[model samples]
Structure formats: C-alpha cells, structure tokens
Target: MDEKLIQRLESAIARLESLSPGSKPPSGTLDAVSAASEPSIVAYDDLLVEYVVKVSLAAEKIGGQVHDITIVLSQAFATQKELLMKIKQTQKPDGGGMTEFLKPLNDKLAQANNMSEGKRSDFFNHLKAASESLSALIWIAYTGKGCGKQKLLLLTSYFPIFNINLASKQQLFALIFSGMSMPIGHVEECWQSAEFYNNKVLVEYKNKDPYHVEWAKALKELYVPGLRDYVKAHYPLGPLWSTTGAVVSAPKSAQPSAPNPPSASLANLASSSSSRPKQGQGMAAVFQEISSKPVTSGLRKVTDDMKTKNRKDRAGFVSSGENEVQKSAPKTAAKTGPPKLELVMGRKWVVENQIGVKDLLIDDCDPKQTVYIFGCKDSVLQIKGKVNNITVDKCTKMGVLFTDVVAAFETVNCSSIEVQCQGAAPTISIDNTAGCQLYLSRESLETSITTAKATEVNVMVPSSDPDADLAEHPLPQQYIHTYQDGNFVTNPVSHSGG
Candidate 1:
C-alpha cells in the first residue's frame, strides 16, 4: 500500500470534522479544470496505444475535448487503478465520504458566501465552464473503456485481461465523486449507499466507501463487458489513447505504433461475461442508467416542481412587461418601480416579476424552453438549472449566489458574471460586462469580449487533486444576437431542439 496516499486520504477525511455547510477556502483553490494538463501517464502497450490514440482523435470529431480525456479522465482511471490495486492486497474497502467527494466544491462555495452578485457570478461561471467542458470525456470514462488496460495491466502485468478482479465498487465511487449523478437502479457489483435525488443529496456509507475492494466475478461479468460495448459505441477513443509513432516524436520507448480504428473484434467482449443487459434492456450502461430522467421518487418530484414553475413563470413573463422601466438606461433612478413578486419558489417563481427584491434560487430550469430571469438589480440571486440562453439584465449592487450545479447557467447581460458548474459549460457575453467582474468558466463561449474590465474569468474546478479536470463537461454557449424584448427575451433560445 502507498502509505502516503492512504495518509493523505485519511487526512482529507479528518478535515471534514471541522467542515460546516457552505464553507469555502481562499482564492486560487479551484484551478481551471478544462485548462489543466493531463496527469503523469504510464505508457501503454502498442495495440492499446494505437487504439487509444484513435479514440482520442474520434473525440475531437464528436466535439468532445480530447485533452480532458487524456488529462482529467486518464488521471481518474489512474487513480481508480492505484486504489483498486491496494484494495486487492487488503481485500477490504476504504471508508469516508460526502465531504470526501464533495468537500472541494462545497468548501469553495461556502467561502464565497459574502461575495457581491457580480463577484459570485464571476466565480460561478468559471467553475461551470471547467465542469461542463469535461462532460463527454466523463461519459466516455464512465463506460469503463478507461478502466481496461489498467485492469489488464494489474492482472497480467503484461496488459491483457486475465485473472482480473474488477474494481466495480471503487469505480462507482470514482464516478459519483467525478460529478456524475447516481443511477437509481441497483448496482450489481459494489455500492455502499449514496443517492442524489434532486438537490437533496443523500449519502450514507460508513468509513466512506472503501478504495480497495474487488467485486465478485458473477457481478463483474454482468457489468464490465456491457460497459465496454457502450464505450466502443459512444466514445470509441481512449483514456488510454496515444498518437501515431511516425507522426509525433517521443522517446522510442513511448512512441506509438500506426493508429488503427477500433476493430470488430472488440464487439464480442461480453460473450464470456454472462447475462448482460441486452441492447434495449439497457445493460450497455451497466454501471449507470442510460436515461437522463430522474429515477427516484425524490428526483421526480423535484423535476416536477421545476417544470411546474417553468409553466407558471412562462405564463407570467409572456403576459407582463416591466412597462415602468424604460428600455434606455435611466440617468436617474425611477421613483416608481414595477409590481412586486411573491419572490418564492412555485408561487412567484419563473422570475418574470421585479427581481430586485428577492434572491433567485431555481433549479431544473430549461434554457431552451423559457426565458427565466431578466432585468433585476441590487439583490442576492442564486439560480440553478441546465445551461441555456440566459439574458441577465442590469443590476447595481447586484449579487449572484452560485451553488454547485449540474448543467450550464450561461447568462446574457449581468453586470457581474460568475458561474461554477460541475459537468457544465458556461459562456458570458462581453456585450454587457465592462469594468464588471466576469469570471467566466474555463471553456467560456465564443462571442468576442472587447472590454478589459477587471473581469475575473477563470475555471474553478473542484478537485482534491488540484490538477483533476473533468472530461464530461457542459455544452457550448448559445449566442442569439437579437436584443431583449422586455422582462422576456425575444431571441429564439433553442439549441438542440433543432
């Protein structure tokens, strides 16, 4: 066992005792996750090398960032590999969690509690960008393609699968901690007990889930091969990929052979594994569920509430305009303001009314479908949802609160912009922010920013390993150039609907 690593893991757990809710560390804690380089990778055998390189190249074709897989994702697999090897020796699982998985993100958010909306938004945007940029890479990894050679390397020490004791449990822990949500289905292999149903997180495992526990063959057979198939179909590239030898020069030892596409031979892998999920049976995503829908009752209810609010908010927004506030910026503040909204979830939610009075804490908001919030000022605001076109109107003394969100929450016109998302891509337009704080996420949107406003744009990735950048991050920012209409945006915000 690597005693130092164990000690570090133990110490990280120890710090949780003093940890409180919403606690965050000082600045520079979160490095630009997307911008982070790959971890120190051990070279792979030739066959694996060629295939992995092809996989990496395929990722670029699919619009996924290849480096994220090489850097963030490859490291995740490496970490899992190292931990699993230790587990096999002891034949026991390590324990400790929640904070173990989430503390890095939580700690930072807590620290920024007092930041003004502008400052908070800047921070949040960066975090969101890093997380989002890593999405596809993560999904590819989750499928177990990344786990292959590591498993092979450990078993034979020669890089071929034999006498393998798969690390399903450890992999699950790694996946969840990597910001992938827990699937509601039973884990056939190894799982202690952690559920993420809606925003209400539920995690309960004694000593946290262990790092070194190997799963049984029966269960492993049921899971691994199917996952390999999924990886073959979707990502096809490698957490293990290396480029062609002749094209790129490396020390002869590290040089890759000619790259060949994934061959048909890999398709039959599950043959020996035993009753895997048949195509429609959804076994392909053995470790995790394929559907993006919420599985648990708790998650469903939360999604329901979000949709319900969207309906109401959409209604209100379509019906009313902040007629009192003129389109043109006023030299002097208006004495009279628009009608006040109830300013709570469900009742006055959907953010159509005067937003200056109340803070916005919303979740599951669909950016493509509705215009959620616009033109608010001088209030603490926190909105959580999938990334979509957001038109943030002007606000003085504005404050935006950012919690760790699953998707991108790109804003259009907020004076101060900060976004932090896990597995989300966030973009900010320079059309509005000038001399305003703009900490856009690491993989920010494409629109040009002419201003040199002390905008604080940086990617804040939440990882115990400062270098860990996620692969399955967010999508690109949708920039529709049309101007805002009123309390509602006039531009069509649809992206994937096409």
Candidate 2:
C-alpha cells in the first residue's frame, strides 16, 4: 500500500480507538485523539481536494478549447478585413482582375459544422454557431454598407462566446462547492468572479448594445435558470459557504456538543458514496451533461402548460363528433396564428410567431422606427416605407420586401430567406443564415452587403442597359487566407468554367 494510504489507515484505526466508550488519552493528547476520531471529516476534506484538482484539470481543458475557438474567430475576422481590402482594391478604377482564391474557409466551417452535429455538447454547438455567425458577419462586411455602429453590432456576437465561457466556469464552481460545509477562500474567489461577470461585465455589455440584447437575455432565460435547477437536482444540500467567508451551517447552539461515533460516521460516509449519482463519472462527463440540458424555466413551463391545455381542449372537440371538430378547427387556427401589426415602444415594429402567412404587411410610415420579424416560417413580410433598421431572425423560408432602409437590413439565425429592396438601403447584413437571395434595385446598387457563416447567397442587381437581363452574382462563401511578408493575405474562392 502507498505510504499515504497506510498513514490514513493508521489514523483511522486511532480514530476508532479514540471513539470507544470510556476511552481516555494522555493529558496533552486529548485534542489529537478527538481530531483522529473524526475520520469521516478527514475523508470529506480529501474528497473536496480531489474535486478541486479535477476542477483544475477540467478548467485547463475547457480553457484550451475556448482558446482554440478564439483563434478561429480571430482568423475569421482577419480574413474578413483582408477580403474587404481586396474588394476596395478591386473597386478602384485602375485595379486589375482578382485572382482565384482557394476554399480553406469553407473547409474550416465544414469542420466546425461536422463537429457540432448530433449528440454534441453545447461547447461544440456554440463553436458551430460562432463560426456561422462569423461567416454571416463576413458576408455583411463584404457586401453590406455600414459605418462604426454596424461594425460594433457585428462584434456583439462575441458576447455569446463570452457568456458561454463564463457559464462553464460558473458550472464548474457549482459542482465543486455543491455540498461543501466549510467556507473555502478559493471557492469564495470563484463565486465573486461569477457575480462580477454577471453583474458587471454582462450588464454593461447589454446596456451598451441594445441591438443584441437577445444574447444577454439568453443567459438569464437559459443558462441561469438551468443552472439553478441543476444545482437543486444534483446537489440538494445546496452551497454551505457564503460570500462573507462564513460557513452556512447549523448554529453553534444547534450543533451537537459531541461528534458522532467513528464507526457510525464511517458507515454513513460509505453509504452516501455508494448512493451518489454518476459516482464514477469524470468531470468532463459532468460538464457535458450540464451543457446538454438548457432548461428555459418560464418558457418551458408555459409550453408544457399550453401543450396540456391544448390536449385537454381538443379531447372534447374530437370526441364529440366530426362536425364539432370541424367547427373548432378555425378557432384553434385563430388562436395560434400571428397577431395583427403592432408598433412597439413607438420606435420598433414587432412581427413574430407567424407561419405560412403570405400577406403580412407593415405599410405604416416609418422613417424613424425599426422592424423586427422573428420565429416566422414560410412567411412573407412587406414593408412599404423606409425604416431605420430591419432584422429578420430565427425564421425559415421567409421572404421580405421593403421600400428602403435608412441604416441596415439584417437577417440572423435564419434559413432560405429572400429579401427585395425596391428603393435603397445603406447596408444589408446576413449572419448565421443560409440560402439568402437579395434583389437589389438600381438605387440600391451602392448598398454594402456583408455576410458571415452564411451560404448559397446570391444577389440580383439591375443591369445598366434597361433592356438587358438582371445580373446574378453569387457571394463568396469560402476563402483562402495566408500570411506573407508580415501581413496576412486573403482571397475568395473562384471556380473556372467547364
């Protein structure tokens, strides 16, 4: 046996001896005997130390992964800057034809997507989302016209990455201190870091970037609630430490004057160990499990209640008769269908949760107001007047037609979206989107288009000759980035004619 194990065994033996009834020790050895008798306390301390080490190792692994993600993000941004420079150069009067670039970026995005497929953890999913968002930002930067504020909005995507990283660290801390009985100084530091990140950094970011508040809200709607439930479920004993370096346990008056017998304490410890859930699992497994479950407390509860009520409501309609079911169908449809036009906060129009609506119109005058369309599927939205900004998010097979936008037209976390600008817009941004078709009018030709993590995007611009057919141009989705002479070089992928 190892020397430490032997020493522990000896100590345990002494503890058992000291705990015997009527036991007595030498005058100077009383305290030692008392300490030795509490072998379970020592065991608990050792277990905490083991967990601390495990947490450290887990932190290193997570840190490395986070670092890798940052590297990829930096590379993507660098490539975007290079592409912008190239576009600027090519647009110059004396600039020559652009060289054919390779598709290395496509390969990187493909790798990220493949890694995030079925049964992957949140870390991988975040990686995929980040990559896709980056691609969308790249597309917007390349194609959309924008000033500093737009660039800042593009940078806001990084907040999700920050949120996830901090959340992971917080979860690790929760795991280690779940059932701790004493106030640990190091653990206190961890708690303070979490509090600071939540109350200071995240709050400030959210306040500054009103356009991207969804990412911050996600931390509260998903991460925070899920973590609260997870701790409650897995560590029912709760945290026994407080921020003031005080142990949160029974008061001195309530605590027993004498500790439990050594035999009983050891028995209880063994039983608890055997009963612990996933006792043999590693820290990585724990983290993975935690990441996999994102319980949106309020949303989930509402959804569940809605489901139950719907089922109950339908039961009578279906069971009564076929005619009754037919009569109730329209009512159900009316209840679930999209709401009428509503201008929110006097500055924004909100259209959400509609499906297969072919004639959704926002015809009201709006030079100062913005528009947001969300969670709609197979829908068409027509905005008749110029708006300050427009964002289409988390929708599928959606089509948008607008007269003009004063600032930017953006699509995010969407798929198969079609946008038509009849007048003009300063910029069009696509991020974390796929299969977008942009129809640009003559007046909108000067509009800048930017995209990141997006694919299969095509732009149709009117030809100079009125009689000529509209020109179709496919945006580059892949690029090759290289370093030469102390500067990074990037080029879009090109295909030769067969």
Q: Give the TM-score comparing model 1 with the true structure, all chains together.
A: 0.22
Off-target runs (Cα >4 Å) in candidate 1 are 1-336, 339-358, 401-414, 435-498
Against the hidden reference, what TM-scores do the models get? 0.22, 0.38
Q: Can you write out model 1's per-residue Cα lDDT over 300-356, one digit (the tens) per residue?
A: 335665675666655545443576446434633453345342334432233433545
lDDT by residue for model 2 (458-497), tens: 9999988999998999999999999999987999988899
lDDT of 1 at 353: 32
Query: Model 2: runs farther than 4 Å from truth?
Result: 1-340
- Measured by TM-score, the strongest candidate is 2
